[model samples]
Target: MKIILDMMGGDNAPLSNLEGAAQAVKEYGVEIIGLGDEAACRKAAAEKNISLDGIQLVNCTENIEMCDEPARAVRTKKDSSIVVGLNMLKEGKGDAFVSAGSTGALHVGASLIVRTLRGVKRPALATIIPAKNKAYMLLDSGANVECRPEMLAAFAVMGSCYMARVEGRKNPTVALANNGAEESKGTPVLREAHQLLKTTPGINFVGNIEPRDVPNGDVDVVVCDGFTGNVILKLTEGVAKMILGMLKEMFMANVGSKLAYLLLRSGVADLKKKMDSEEYGGAPFLGARQPVIKAHGSSKAKAIKNAIRQAKICVDNDLCGTMQAALDELAAQSAGE
Candidate 1:
């Protein structure tokens, strides 16, 4: 399978992307179409002693900057890596697209170029968050800030299909991110969403799930509006960092503490690995006609490589097709009612 990669998107651009692309090609045996300034990419790879074997290069003269307006940049910057790569996906030149570019620009380009499933009102940015014993999918993580009740219901369906097909979870339990577990909690939209999700076909809706319950691995999918979901995502990341920092400080306090750390060093390493965002690679823009993965803007070689792996998994599992069928079913149910 061919994966379209935006080689100049992230902070460690060109070099990191090239190294990651090489690693992905070697490990996954998939062809990669690298998009960016061909000359720059070649120079960077040569300096880094990285081989570009098994990868194709596409020369894109322009790049969408993080400061640029998302919609305008997508429309006018025809030669940009983000726009060109997404166009390639739309034309079926590749099975999926991976980018660590401006999130806004990527989202706009994917929606306008690749388009969403026929009946999908809005595509959601879905990310996997590591919990106590399991990692759960969180939707609308930072896409649509405000959402309708029906949108949340659709997110539930899309999230469920994603977890089941890509993550190998079966009949994944889904819940609404709410203030309390009570049915009557949350704003009017969330309450309405809870009711709709209860009867939404293709998903195992498990009523309301408080934010506190999320880290306990209580649900497979957590559905919320973009505003709420983004808050949860950022807050969770901050907490993990703070805890790890505290642990490091405590371990280095004195000779006695240092010795103690040696005994628990392996366990700490495991914990760090479990909470690392790089493990998941990137977040998929679910509902897009083709897979569009948004890697962290600051991603390095390891993160970029994993992001490529993620794109491959989504394509192999037919993520878009699965989501389309689920959305069609939901639409039919709505019509019947």
Candidate 2:
């Protein structure tokens, strides 16, 4: 399978992405198509001692800036490496697309290029996050600001399909993010969403789940509007950072604490790795007709490499086709009854 990588799309563009691509190619045995200036990519690859046997290069002259509007950038930045890479996927030149560029650029480019799956209202981004018990999938992670209850339900369905097919989780439980477990809790949106999820027979609707339930590793699928989801996602990251910082400060506050920290350094590192977003790579634009993985802007080689690996799993599992069939089946059932 051919996987496309943006040559200049991250904090350590070309270098980090190239290194990751080399690693992916070596480890995964998949062909990589790097998009950027041909000469630059060649120079970087040479410096890294990456074999160009299966690696392809496509030079793009223009680039969408980090600050550019996604819509405007997609329309005007025709020669950008990201646009080129996604176009390749749309044209069936590649199986999956991976980028560590502007998140907005990826969403807009993917929607416009590869297109959304049939029966899918909006293509939502979903991430498989590590929980205490097992990995859980979070949908519409700040992808759509406001979502219809039906749209949120669609995300649940798609997320469930991803879990069952890709991660092999059978009878995945879907839960609506809310203030409490009682049906009376949350705004009319979530309350109504809870009712819809319950009525939707295909999904394993688990009723309302609080934010605290997420880290507790209770549910497999957590659904929410992008507005609420982005807030919770960012807040979770912020809290993790603050707690780590406080621990470090406490550890260095005195000689006793320092000794204790040294004693527990390995355990602390393991815990930190568990909470590290980089270790999970990036999120996949789940509801689309094609497989697209979005990496963080500040991501390094390892993160980008993991994202590429994620795309391969997505393709191998046929996530798009599985999601399409599941949704079509759900829609037909609704129409029948």
Q: Taking the candidates one at a time, how many backbone clashes does each contain?
A: 0, 0
Give every collision pair in model 1. none
Candidate-wise lDDT, in order: 0.92, 0.85
Candidate 2: residue pairs that collide? none
- Candidate 1: lDDT of 57? 95
User: Candidate 1 residues 1-337, lDDT tens each?
Assistant: 9999999998999888999999999999999999999999999988889998998999999999999999999999999999999999999899999999998888788789999997776688998999997999999899889999989988999999989988899899999999998899999998899899999998999999988888988789999999999999999999888988998999999999999999998998899888888889999998889999999888889999999999999989988988888999999999999
Question: In model 1, where do residues sit more than 4 Å from their true spots?
Answer: none
TM-score of 2: 0.96
Clashes of 2: 0
Give me the displacement of residue 136 in model 1, in angstroms: 0.5
Off by over 4 Å in 2: none
Most lDDT-accurate candidate: 1
